[model samples]
Target chain A: MSTLSERILGAPHGNYVDRKVDRAYVCDGTGMLTLETWKRMGAARLSDASRLHVFFDHIVPANNSTTATLQHELREFACNSSLTLSDIGGGICHQVMSEGIVLPGEVVVGADSHSCTSGAFGAFSTGVGATDMAAIWLTGETWFRVPDSIAIHLSGSLRGGAEAKDLALSYVNRLWMDGGTYCALEFIGEGVKTLQMDERLTLCNMAVETGAKTGMFYADDITVQYLAAKGQTVRPQVPETCTYIRNLELDLGDIVPVVAVPHRVDTIKPVQDLAGLPLDQVFVGTCTNGRYSDLVRFAKIVKGRKVAVRTIIVPASRQVLSEAVRTGILADLVDAGCTIGTPGCGPCLGAHMGVLGEGEVCLSTANRNFRNRMGVGGEIYLSSVATAAASSLTGEITEPEVA
Target chain B: MMQGIGHAVCLGQDIDTDLVIAGRYLRTKDHSQWVAHVFEDLDTSIAPRLKGAVIVAGKNFGCGSSREQAAIALREAGVVAVIAPTFARIFFRNAINIGLPAIECNITCTEGQKIRFNLADGWVEAEGKQYPIRPLSPRMQEILAAGGLVNYWKARS
Candidate 1:
């Protein structure tokens, strides 16, 4: 059994000096890397500089000068520093980190906040800023307040239309905006065992919504097999005994597809509740929903149907992209009027690609729906792969009405 | 109470730790590295005026990402305490846990009211008037006196 509370935070880790961490790493979403942002690598003060991984899951092809600079800097940094670069269009930060990099019971921090996504594998991960990243890049030491813990046990399996995304969203919503603030969410119970590693990744990816420092699901066989297939070693973990602040009861039932209407993520309502909400754009890729299986679902829907006018599909990775092409999913999407593009972190950052003009409404699979998050004054409605697909066909929010 | 060092006032939100100290010069562990860029965002007059002070700001002032540097920066820069309408929840906990004397003081004035705060008296003096900054309901005050959250954790351990 591993007793590792002090690993990510407590004492000075390994041979590094006692460098205190300020807060936690919640993970910033895609498009840039920080270690090279300040050029602090292999400084032993920062434990295992190579431990800080980089992947281009957000943007496959750097579209402009600034983004291109970021990409080039990463390549140069990884090569010069002898660090492992995970993705050349990897699916998403969480999945890539979980499939191999992190071991059970370890504490991980990323420059991205959703680094909490790695918690699904039983290691604690969160994000932070670049300066902090620079410090962590130099010395893996960080300061943590040791947040209160919340335990949620899942009992039921997800129905067809529900997917892990909806359940994850509902969990945060149930917790309310500040419900889980300053807490570590531990998703336990037999229901969690039913989820595929990919599905579990989706569940933990949104842990940030409730302001949680991290969300966790213990690592099991699925985790080992995934790593084994990639020729990586897997570690074991022991459960935490800390009492949870709140324990939610979740049983999988036939959940009708749901959509989070704009302005705030928790303002979500059923898709039928989204009637008459006209949209100008539809985006289908993000750290949350851009994955191989997610694309396959889109392909299933759009293959026989036309995408809503102006709808676009951004696969989470080039690997997902190549897989889509080889699997015929890409051809199906374009056949349905969907404009497919390179796997770059797009409008999700509210910076580039698929931006909605003022007053335009967009149906997106990204996490936040804050004003101007995707586009200034433009509205974003959050939904799952099935709902995004169904809404793409109608140019309005709609549910698949399927299991 | 604003007792130890009179309350401070740092105007505006998103006053990141970098504004407290630019990244280019923070390679040391001593608080001495702080004075250079204490208020890089606002007027440079801040450091000189902060012989002892507390900060006052608006809602979600510490919104966005978390950087402990902000706390260390403020603490080292000599901010005795912080008073805001509402905080980002994290910073509020952080400032208090680290022994930075942060309190929640409801302000009636719309904006820009300069006043005096007596930590010894537990009063907030502004707009030619005086208001109590305490009445923290006991448990809250104990946490504040213990010197912020992490210190409390260390003491407990």
Candidate 2:
């Protein structure tokens, strides 16, 4: 038997980046669709039995008619397919499926770009176009291109002021815009040595922003230990060796506070550069920097302060929600009059959940602020949670003043 | 890598794969049904009048996902080539990897700037400069000559 990597790279018949390669469909059982936008296709494709997950999540708080329609379709599809993960209302799509569904070494695809989040479980996860996803939904298979690989090694101690959000933004800046195209970004290093599981998840969540197919920080003892506590799957262990085409190195010690300005991710500069720039709003959420530490960081910054007239905080998961509540961070936030939101993706997707209206400028920790991405007549500047939090309080672009 | 002033239009940055062909219309069986709809959101007249069109854009012109459909839809819709101050990391590679002529140069084109791009001749004429962009690496030239990956592989067989 050929090794899995060999099968992945050698079989052009089954590998494609959209140029009609041959048929090579196999199931490792790491995916499913909860919405019927995919149901317009057949159900047997999901009967790959092991490959299907068909979950209904992240479409909640149905803020508008279109989201409501998609959610209704998802309920119908999940019911028709008899899938367990379907209709699991209260979690992010990535969190819901992997809670107990996705297994290791599985090659999975989803329509959502963040589908790569499954790599945390050691699966070969990537996102697909809705049409390709539809075809896979009918035939139970799709193809792929053997992408090049880039290794990002994070080594050193994260000083008191730095966090994963800072690290991710720093990494993106170093690579600039076209640094990691059609490549697999493999994150490795020593500073990663002490980061807990959710923090590591926060790092890999935005890997797609670099134009990489997926970002995978290898699962080590930390991975297994966290899973064991959750009672999730414990797969055999091995060191992840890299066949990276190139390597970029980083030390958390020197990563300065930064923000990606309007229009482009690579146009990043130190947050201090834009001092006194008026800020109309500040947002702290999205799959990227919306974890517990993110909230804790925001709370710490806003403890004795009040949000400038227009600032919002969006927690990404119910898990982060409960933990923030348990630690009393949510109360500190509300006491400061920061408009805290439910555990759904809001400001990030421009789903209108927390959009800033026309002529408004928001400093945010969310990713991808494309035209109208957050709402009409609004401009979004991408930044770390610390920057967003500090800006919310000062009512202008600022840094976390917390010592 | 196109030739002559087929005409140039300026589009703002963050021009995603969806702006080329929206995700919702992807389910259609006939590509013409949807490919023709490419960029309808940006400019309705673009598709019908693109038989000999060229585009010049600011940096990160196609900086989004590795969706080749974006290139395919553009090619099928008659966009000869693109010259950008810079391009998205993935979109740049995807274009070249799939044998589409996408060039990156440190230049800008104003609206209605007369331009002649010769991918075959290996240079461009824009804003009164005939600067050179290295032509397709030999392997890439072959892929583009073959008119896409499937045909290239078919010829190899």
Candidate 3:
């Protein structure tokens, strides 16, 4: 009996194993460094150019000439090397990869920490540093110290305005930062089936916040349906009994909307505890909660109501953006006085597009709230799209009404 | 045994990678900018003091982001080593991959106190006390001694 990570890596807990990478990617911020390291290593011939991807999402449209030149160089490298490139506005790298590229039971590695987001699809995915990625580009393989697994058993279904983001916050609060370090969080139980693909992605996206190697759900019909919709088919993975370092059980029905307070993702509290707190801005997008379902939930909350504060809406990808446009969700958000930015990681990493100013506060749906992450001296509060939309309507941290 | 001595610089717990190098400076590959701006968020004065320094920090040091630039910045800034009770896994790997020693040990020392360490012996001496560290694997020690994974790989190839 083996956990998903052990099954994929063919190694037991705490053992080092080198496996061939099925997919490897890097964003612009890391891509330049990776390219430099590759050159430093004699520009060795790539092992598998087709499996490599370069995404420009962190700082899109060039924040300045230096960025523009670097992006231009990356574009040239991608083209010359025959690697896949997702240009500016293509959406976040993880979101784009999840659209159909990443399959179940494959080894996926990205330079960005959010790469673990793909583990939602049942792949053994994790993030590595840029130089490590450069080595992957050269050798097509990397080593991992197979982490022990922690089985998280979830039951019941979320209700009453609670969302996957809230559940994610709840789990992180329980685990605390670094509690799951060097461990794989295997989410399994009746509640796993209750979550749709978007929610599953949300859960896995925040795994890194716990300092975990990855968060994963075993592939089932929900996973099958999600891939099937994209014209791909996959078999459901049978659950096998495996030893876990720790076992945790969560009842989703008991969950309520919560927010991760400033400076730490694990500093969580129910939304009502911080209600009525004024906000300088509200952002609804990121790999964490920037999908079609998330936008729909956000639009449902703020529809036909004027926002009381500056709100930014960034779709996860071009596909998500066009779906919002085709379905009138974009119009509803725009009519509510929300500013639409390019479909990328907008102001999530304090890179560009609506970065918070000194002494400013923002309620965002993105993951991390680490100090100075969005901007120096600026505060970030993380929550669900529902909580973000509810807050935007009143210009304060507000909990959403039961849907 | 590869080892060195340097003045100690102390910091508290959970020092994240963003504080090591902000996203605003990531667009440029100029290593000097990274060295200059390292720890600017915490204190601009820390950068000037980093040269030949052994940073002794609390637990979970380098906790967020997988940016290798953080490790690069510290190495280029002439940091002799970083000693913490624990490290975020990715940062620990990045540090070793870049030839920056990330020692796992618990030690208390005042700022500017001279510190001595032995990587092979897995112990650090500060303020007339010796604290044993979790020894690195032979593979990791080889990479660090080779000045990083690139050089290690080059020698192998």
- Model 3, A359: alpha-carbon shift in Å? 1.1
Candidate 3 ranges beyond 4 A from true positions: none
Q: Compared with the true structure, what per-residue lDDT tens digits does model 2 show for residues A205-316?
A: 6677776667765567777777776677566335445466789999888877777776566677777888767888888876677777788988988887888857787776
- Candidate 2 per-residue C-alpha lDDT over B71-154 given as tens digits, one digit per residue, 9 for 90 to 100: 667767777677776665446545654456776654566765666777777787877788687555555566566654334444
Q: What TM-score does candidate 2 reach?
A: 0.73
lDDT string for model 1 (A36-80, tens) is 323323332434644656666544455555556656766776666
Cα deviation at A236, candidate 3, in Å, is 1.1
Please give the distance, in angstroms, between residue A303's alpha carbon in candidate 3 and its true position after superposition. Answer: 1.7
Best by DockQ: 3
Q: Which is better, 1 or 2, measured by lDDT?
A: 1
What is the alpha-carbon lDDT of model 1 when measured against the actual structure? 0.63
Model 1 Cα lDDT, one tens digit per residue, B1-157: 3355354465664343334544333333344666666665346777776656656765344433344445567777766667765554445544554567666666554333455655445676666666766445343456566654333333543
Please report the candidate that would top TM-score against the real structure: 3
lDDT, model 2, position A212 = 62
RMSD of each: 8.2, 7.0, 1.2
Candidate with maximal lDDT: 3
- Worst 10-residue lDDT window for candidate 3 chain A reads A36-45
Candidate 2 segments whose C-alpha is farther than 4 A from its true place: A1-45, A54-59, A84-89, A97-104, A235-237, A240-242, B1-14, B18-62, B65-157
